[model samples]
Target: MSDLAISVRGLTKVFGGRRVVDGFDMDVPKGAIYGFLGPNGSGKTTTIRMMCGLLTPEAGDGTCLGFDILRQSQEIKGRVGYMTQRFSLYEDLTIRENLDFIGRMYRMKDRGARVDRALVDLGLAERAGQLAGSLSGGWKQRLSLAACMLHEPELLMLDEPTAGVDPKARRDFWDEIRRLSARGVTVLVSTHYMDEAVQCDFIAYIAYGRKLISGTPKDIPRLVGLQTWVVEAGEVGTLEAALKADPDVAQVARFGAMLHVSGTDEARLEAVRQRHPGQWQKLDGGLEEAFIWLMSGAQDNFAGPAARGGA
Candidate 1:
């Protein structure tokens, strides 16, 4: 089999006469955790659905798990394990029951053994009889993951699986995902958290349904060509306001107690710094800085003056 689990181009999805996902392209290598990140309305979810064969794109050609997205959607679906944003397992059913139910849906030959193994793999064997609803968010996440793995899918698609999960739980869940990836399961997960996005083997940042950049987390910042400096001052808002009026200052954001001042051109950014001198430190930028730069350049395709609804 090819090393690329997903390879697609020009994936488009239109809703209400607006292209929510416009001419998107992505490539996820097999057994790698690929992070899909963007603002809420930037079409991250829409693009993943198209890639997973759940939502048909208006125009695109792609292969997911080696099945043609356009012509073999059913084949694609069968091999892909999808876990949605919400907790999708039955609340009333026990953990083992949920796994059994999923196994039955797939009509596995040894349903009982499959359920037992899933429980053991997910560390839910002790609580096999406990109701899914009663479990904590992290446990619920574990249950959802266990259910998805019941079919032994080649690809796993997770949509914001750590939204409400606690920090420790989120870390543990990601560790599990990495374990799966190491076992030759390709994982494509979407997340808003920058920390989580940085953990992926590869990342793709999309804005307004268009891809802004795709690369290793380390490569993205350098590729964006952002020059960043941190201003450590008692009054950041005052300095931020003062720099906002300057044309050379491309972006100014508060990072904890400090201010992250950045721009595309180093000379221009330095000029902005010289204009407002203080206890500042010039440092290498990271993914968060590059993402903000990407967002600033993206246009809201649906927020145009005509043909749109008002809030």
Candidate 2:
């Protein structure tokens, strides 16, 4: 447990007679970038809040950054940085003003120096005078991260930090996170992007408030027990319908110009694939395919197949 940045078990939360998070357990190693992933309302944010001491779990005990989540919540909160899904900082405030404000909120003696360092660290030194409202989504994300880092917390709990940002900005944001992890800062970030989820040292997928899968990215594919094949045709109009008719083809989706067909039953899937005609290529299972298959099997509490959106 000493090597863990977050250790929690039986973490549960409820609201309005609905269980939002149920019997969730997790262990995130220190200095590791841990990805918390799930569809919307899968309890990723609620679990983060519980681990960070912002919201108490109705049925759980844990320690975050060496502090008890229930008893030492204040201490845990003081040492951790949390960024919400939305831009919560003052939009009208300039980058410098925002950092200064956060620094003052932490009541640090060298507030100016810390803010300056944060600006330099986040590449906002030059744009420190620009208003956050006028900045792009990526820039606003950087500001929010800078705000979270003002006090130099040991853990960063970012909930979908790259939601509306561009690809380049998202990449840059993740690059900085890697730098922080290299400096021995433990980061727990929740994101729906498979590209971003792949960047973490460890990742966990939750569905309907239950943890579906958790492990290193390399191992998660194996956990799902999937076999895959790629099929490409000038127009796979009939081929797709044919594959769907077979029960062995558990999952099928168009991947760009081609279609990625997957199933847990490799023998049956391969047999079906052999019978089909197209540019057939046997492929290894992937994270995106695994997640899609997993989500399809899980029940969505709030809405139907088309109504819900996530990972």
TM-scores vs. true structure, each candidate: 0.91, 0.93
Could you give candidate 2's per-residue lDDT for residues 147-227 as a string of tens digits? 898898999999999998999999999998999999999999999999998899999999878898899888887898887
The most accurate candidate by lDDT is 2
Instruction: Provide the RMSD of all predictions against the true structure, rounded to 1 decimal.
Output: 2.3, 2.9
Candidate 1's C-alpha runs over 4 A off are 300-311
lDDT of 1 by residue, 95-197 (tens): 8888888998887899999898888877778989999999999889988988888899999999999999999999999999998999999999999898998
Error of 2 at 5 (Å): 0.3
Candidate 2 worst ten-residue window by lDDT: 302-311
C-alpha-based local distance difference test score of model 1: 0.85
Report clash pairs, candidate 1: none
